[model samples]
Target chain A: MTAGTEMSGPRGTLPREVPSASQDSVPLLEAKGLNVWFGRHRRQALRDVSFRLAPGQRLGLIGQSGSGKSVTALAVMGLLPDTARTTGSIRFEGRELLGAPERALAALRGRDIAMVFQEPMTALDPTMRVGRQAAEAVRLHASATSRATRRRVIEAFAEVELPDPERVADAFPHELSGGQRQRVLLATALLNRPRLILCDEPTTALDVTVQAHVLDLLDRSLAASGAACLFISHDLAVVARVCQDIMVVFDGAIVETGPVARLLANPSHPYTRGLIAAARLDEAAPGSRLPTVEDFLRGTGS
Target chain B: MTAVFTVDHVSQVFQPRRSALAVVALDDVSLTVGKAERWGIVGESGSGKTTLLRLLAGLERPTSGAIAFEGAELTPAGRDSQRGFQDRGLRSRVQLVFQDPRSSLDPRMTVGAIVAEPLRGRRRRAGASSLSRPDRAARTAEVLAAVGLSADAARRYPHELSGGQRQRVAIARALAPNPDILLADEPVSALDVSVRAQILNLLTDLVAQMGLTLVLVSHDLGVVRHLCDRVAVLQHGRIVETGPTEQIYARPRQPYTQELLAAVPRLPAVLPPSDERKPPRPLQK
Candidate 1:
């Protein structure tokens, strides 16, 4: 894509023609006033969270750890822990998903909604061959023969640009480098051809160079498969690179929501402003004090 | 300027318990860190950045090549001594801050005890002339305050404090020795986005205030550029490129270094003019 060319805009100016989700289309996934409380004390985890994802659209959920971003994704998947209680509505393809049956959610998980987690090692089974794991993902969602499943797994690995797909498939997770392991996870996520991909800091554990490769692969794959993605990350630059829309969540709620270009051009929330200021370390003078979230919060008296 | 550390053609090799093949972690790597100068060692995982930091911290001796601390060769300690460096002076002069405070800081110990642990080593070496109990308490309080933690924080445990506060405690412990050099291994990599700036700012201030020679190892070039004047790029355990941070960032000599720089996702160079920006308001539920 010509997205790389758009980055050369005199540094401070927003990228030209930033993609925004089509508002007129029927929403693929929609959440309304989502609230989550955990355990016996009913401690609130999420508060009045609401957003919409159009078909084939990319939405970035920006927040730090424990900011309810991950919880929102888990809530959509109906994968929240048993002790947690959720209210409000989550609809996927015009079907209510919040209180869906376990069997029904299981069937929809890998077939329609696939998730890629931050840490590949923990997410993947250490004892299983990486190829077999990919095959298992395919086997669960589809009724393909064993040989066909193996071929599909190999094809998925090749599609994710893993070199020597056969060799990588046979190797254990411990043998592969961090980038290679993350690719295996990505290949597994894409093997089912899910319509929606939920990436929760998929490249957070990777090196910058490896992260670039993975993000590029994801961007290309999403474009090719016409799959929508909900990319969650604490890094605004990374989220901005892959996602068209930005949602800034603070504490348990979203503080701002807008197109990526608009958000970067003029952030309206103090927390969002602080995040942008902190992330622009390239522009910060050497040895100068960086503006923190507290500085922004205090300056605005919020 | 005097060199705080001189790593001469260092090479580190590790052999697994039963494996015939040996892994060369660092191959003929050499660098010099001047006193009070911040140097960043950038590399991917398994590129020997942490291994080099460990070598510099005197946690492990290199398989080959000599390391001189302040012009004095650091030799292995005697069997009777538990420290890595034979010289007591060198042992107390260099301190290390690890990546994750959750695992690095002992969960069993209170914040006060953890920060004061290094001082006890000094006390042991000083014998009768060591600091008194009250003096040690005062020193602990002072370091904690310097790291932006209150004195009351000393009474808490690692789990009781936030991730940022735990890191502050780790920095306070590293500073308790009043060392001339600070070796940080991905110090802020595990922190939240909002908290990273605070820690970086704190490190910058403390390094300047204490005149510390810092060796920061990280994969984040932006962080390295913000903190280090000079940078050494390590690839496959070798020094691929080394120069001023700005020089390397602007015109990298190696293709690998250029690719590494390009891969970093960058925010816009500057935000729009303030007049175009809107004042922020509190989000209503």
Candidate 2:
């Protein structure tokens, strides 16, 4: 299929370039036949998952809870637990990351590939001031003076559109609201202008209005930095709003993959169809039973 | 229609122990829930939607104004009392289903005991005139079945069940008392997408079958639009908009409501025709 143009939202600005799926341009991050199992019982978490993320491309991995979405992100970050066993290949910037040394992976983590987690409160330190916490990223990635680091932190804070940047910088994690904390996380993620960003349900805990603002900021930031993004979320609408392409995962496997508009208009997989049907509550008739996953899966003879 | 609940200018304020200023959680909120009417309280975090629901559930009395149930004023519970409802009858008539069944369900107790606990409370109050042990067991099984759980499910603990099954247990416990009003707080926010649909369908079916009044609190407008006829949008402890769901969705009067509705992410409006889609296969059962 031909590369689709970037879908625009009310406040969204188009990216610098659309990453063509068929083009032979070198991908920023590529996963091939990735599989993960946990514990002594060998419980499978991910099953032959694979995808390519081109530079400046925003791909959404949409799935329900425990569908191996977060596991995929964690595997890329080299943050999975010790009990788990992983096979297959993960390449970032032409370097194989599957069995790479921890020291090498650590060096690349915050500087080249940053992650923004779902729960900002727990992700941040309660005792550290917000500005100081953000400065840590700059302190580790770059050799800069304390004064310069402080200025950069404030600048990052302002970039994420946090109100009263200096005041927010001084406040602890508890002082800020959920949305504010998430902004702090975003600022930290973008501190080094990473080549790729792995966001796992970053806006799930936020209110709709706050979520929209954060998403808008993320879109603008990614466009400005020209960074590839693997945005993971369970909400289809949220994914469609931010991503150029979407991969629908169910039970640790990709059920369907395509451009957001084409997938939504004509979903081929039963699971994807059920998910779209369930989320499109506006189209559902009031007082009628909503279609569930089982309803769609029953006749498919999977 | 007779009003099941009349919340009259209720305001809840909390004064921090160290702070001189008082935090106003609910600012003179007034609304009426008519009999069998499904009302949704929509809001973002820190918008006081939960505070309003708690006030209606008789869990907390407002610092000012009064709340009436069936035209009778709700008074605070006396000292050493567990519940805030002064009238024991009101306590038995209203039930609450909380978000995150993981925290809501008592993990130590069997599902049967948890569902039957309400019946025992009523029996203790009614002094031997309420349901006997056998009848209570029968009622527990009946409610479990109503929620799509089997009679054998009563023997298992909450940990033994999936997220969806645990929520069903919570629903069974709420319905066992046969309450006239059901208040659910973000019922499906914690569940997976598929499980959320099943629970939503179950709630719709149960509410219709029982003719129960529902007060659903959610941050998702789509869920609210699907389950409720009327909606009350709350922001920072005040009701900004209150009207029919269709009117609120189509033409929001308040700027805040409009912003809230517009912020909700929606799918592209180019779905294929329903008939063009493959027909669902027959149910294996």
Candidate 3:
């Protein structure tokens, strides 16, 4: 239990940061009734999902493996493959996204929307120079020549706090540890000065110590840049730490959404409650049987 | 306390010859799995939780540590005793459920056959006739039912079952011979969260109903907290903290343990000032 209570006591009002009552602030991104369907059968992946993210508001997109959190992130970035069927409105800084031309979406991606996948080892080009890759991202979206792009790449490297940016620029993906590789990816994302950064399990592959550091960097990055973010993760604790508000997605829909503390403390939905109840550590007594496996996780409860 | 398995100052060091990089995976870690204790080994990735489990399962001999089973050293079993202790009778004593259920179960065999594999040795020991074809089928069906799957579901292949169902089949296979100890390594980490509780509950029930010693290895503190009685925190191949789950949670002495507990989502909302924050930042390898 927390030694000191937060701003909202018994009523559990969201800490002053939530901005639950205000909408005047220009949101960097908004998902309004976004719906996604896939396959020849048109299997629905998201149903009427909605959220508003102000500039620099770090939010968590949490759910089990199949919760559609990844799908949602892909859709927001306009990077979904040709096979995926998409519906719904996604506006970026008041710019309409749905039905936008491919060229327009392409221009916005590396510049306005950037993403870091779960596995940096797989996502990165094994043979490509780390600096060269970062430069390529800058060159693609920025109106700059190769020399200027190289300088921007080094600047981006410094922004992510990588040591010896020049040296890292020459190194390949395999030459760095898992956390360093992730930092490279973050640098790549930062190169475009993106407004909305989407991170999909950025630290899942790293050690706890490394995860903590990477997450701290991510947190500071959000604060420093005032960049709105959609952080997708299976680790709810990590999610709770970074995100002011959380959307509990299960299957293809949002099962619950509220301030992180309230949802974890007093979940209204059974699925949300089960996740919290099941998340308990040391609930089992010595020499006694534990509660029935919640099974909420076994099947599609969300 | 009578522990089914005991690790006495065990440590493993992997050295690449001609190089100074001697990777130490375990550091004289010692812990006792008291009989019937649902013990949890919790740590983040590379904290050596899985390596510790591998050591306890006797898959690899520790570089410098003594492991005793029923007061007998396990590292140096005689040839005949090694075969008997490791092969046929292991299911009746200890069994393991892997992290990925789909990959763990062989695709060629049906679920029923998978569950029956462990029963063969157990049947041979209890009575020669006990494992006849029909009897084998009956016992397989019984174990499947105990794990909450119908016998009819056993005829399906691994691909045919969902992730949760596949895990149940894996559990059924592990429990078929009724092992006194079950070591589940991230058994549900790969599954959906909604279904994680059900699998955890099933394991809890099995431990009580069968009087089994469960050594659960997982990075998810939530699952471990819900399932285990005693929790052990491991770091850099060392057992940093060991105590009753409540005591460990209520007051963690080690910095690693405290960091882990702080990372937990269920912790009451306590956003300390930046000065008080000791949360680990990512390390430089």
Candidate 4:
């Protein structure tokens, strides 16, 4: 065992409070040999990346932009633009998704899988009431009466802990603050009762206090529903706070993956170490100089 | 006596409509910025740090209070401060360096023209009817060198230079008028972490060398701890905690202040023979 990494128990679903978590068995969702490219120039957005989304696994996908984190999620959901070309084997409980028809993919989305994006304004309709939008997502996946739909919407809103569902439902996108809008976006994603969620920088646009609240709401919902999530963020501190396991993505490839405690404690890959080192510098030590990019490069080199 | 400016009892309330709720941006916020004070205002979004800086700059009027620059009221008593604000002498006394330098600087204008803008204004303010073309070029070159930029940057657009270089040009423009104080709102927050230190150091050096008073609006407490002697922790339009930076960090009174301090990342200890690491809070499963 690596030094000081003995507390890292086997990759299994242990009790809560362990902080150390990983998957020893098969995952709920698995992607194998994924590839994505855009434009006639064949710009590769993702390059042969693979990871699993196991039940109760709060996995963080950390990387800078163009590092292939977002593109991988988009490809899984069949939401990539027509300009993009893809080749990958995505399996959800032994089912292949790469070649799955558009209709099948649509059925899977919101019902089996849902995504919360960075900007809620883009995910939500500006003109439509937030409640109706959420209701429509629920109705699209499950057959329900108007009253039942209203109940589900209220439940979803309550799940995300929105203060007042009725007022928020009646309110337009502009009426809610940045934090409220993000909660509504999460509520919309949950309306379909998806088993797994793809959170792509959902809290990046929010304030720190509000981001804490949003993250708490997510963890609470995940705990209750047994829904695993792939949480992506550029900040490793936030990732350490939220994720059980982390997959360090860089240059369109996942260079390292391990339990959160193990990865943060001793990152093996150079890129992973660079991220951890960069994140560690944020510690407010007095009188000491913060590490520069050159230091980060040197650490990565080592 | 090296203090360049002081903001005292500043309070601003926006009353857009008769029935609309009045928003108090700052309340009795007072601070004395020393010659080399790299003061930072930190808080969550809507914490009124930006509003306080504006009041200091005479950009907006405090519903009640005063801003004194070397004992001269920024909001002059008899005439509109707006009149003095436009006066090249008063305007150049305190300058603002905005957050997004790319947008703050005119894209069409080259670096030389942007830096030279204030110099020409100063000349015109001094009743210089005209200047020889050679003289204008010489003045621009002098200011550019002082800001540590090469003459070649004179020809490049704001987009041509990196973020740090663009900020340097902005600093050069502000320095052109030779302001005694510079107010920067969340400067370098948009830049990558690596670039942030360079900008912070530049502001520190500028203050020490040029004797500039810097009132920085930022959410970074670590930067504030290193730069400022004292800090006022604002919460919900109120100054919850104000004290020496060392004291505030050592013994945070307000829970919000404590929370903000706690949030600043701690360098993860590369654990020695021991295994377990203690975090501030345990992860809730």
The lDDT of each candidate is 0.86, 0.86, 0.76, 0.74
lDDT for each residue of candidate 2 in A75-102, tens digit (9 for 90 to 100): 9999999999999999886678888777
Worst 10 residues of 1 chain A by lDDT: A11-20
Docking class of 1: acceptable
The better candidate by lDDT, 2 or 4, is 2
The CA lDDT at B234 in model 1 is 96
Give the lDDT of residue B143 in candidate 4. 72
For model 3, the superposed segments whose C-alpha errors exceed 4 Å read A1-27, A127-135, A143-180, A203-210, A234-236, A255-257, A261-268, A279-302, B1-3, B17-20, B77-84, B107-109, B120-130, B220-223, B267-285
Give the CA lDDT, 0 to 100, for residue B199 in model 1. Answer: 98
Local accuracy of candidate 1 as per-residue lDDT tens digits, A1-302: 48776555334322223233643344778899999999999988899999988777788999877888999999999899999999999988767787767776887887789999999999999999999999988888678998999999999999999999999999999999999999999889888889899999999888788999999899888878878899999999888778777899988898899877789888898889888887887788878898888888788522
What is the DockQ for all candidates, taken in turn?
A: 0.36, 0.35, 0.16, 0.19
After superposing candidate 4, which stretches have Cα over 4 Å from the reference?
A: A1-26, A282-288, A298-302, B77-80, B88-180, B188-212, B264-285
Give the top-scoring candidate (TM-score): 1
- How close to the true structure is residue A290 of candidate 2, measured as C-alpha lDDT? 87
State the lDDT of candidate 3 residue by residue for A1-302, as single tens digits: 46455442534212233433545454668889998888888888888888877666677888777779999898887777777777778878777687777777777787888998888999899989988888878877657988888888888778777889889899999878788889999989877778789999888666556677788788777766766779998766677767766788877889887767677767776666666655543454533433322434454433
Give the interface RMSD of each candidate.
Answer: 7.9, 10.7, 7.8, 6.1
Candidate 1: residue A143 lDDT (0-100): 81
Clashing pairs for predicted structure model 2, backbone only:
none
Residue A60, model 2: lDDT of: 93
Model 2 stretches astray by more than 4 angstroms: A1-24, A300-302, B76-86, B122-133, B271-285
Which digits, one per residue and each the tens of the lDDT, describe model 4 over residues A91-142?
Answer: 7755777767777677788887899999888878999999999898888777
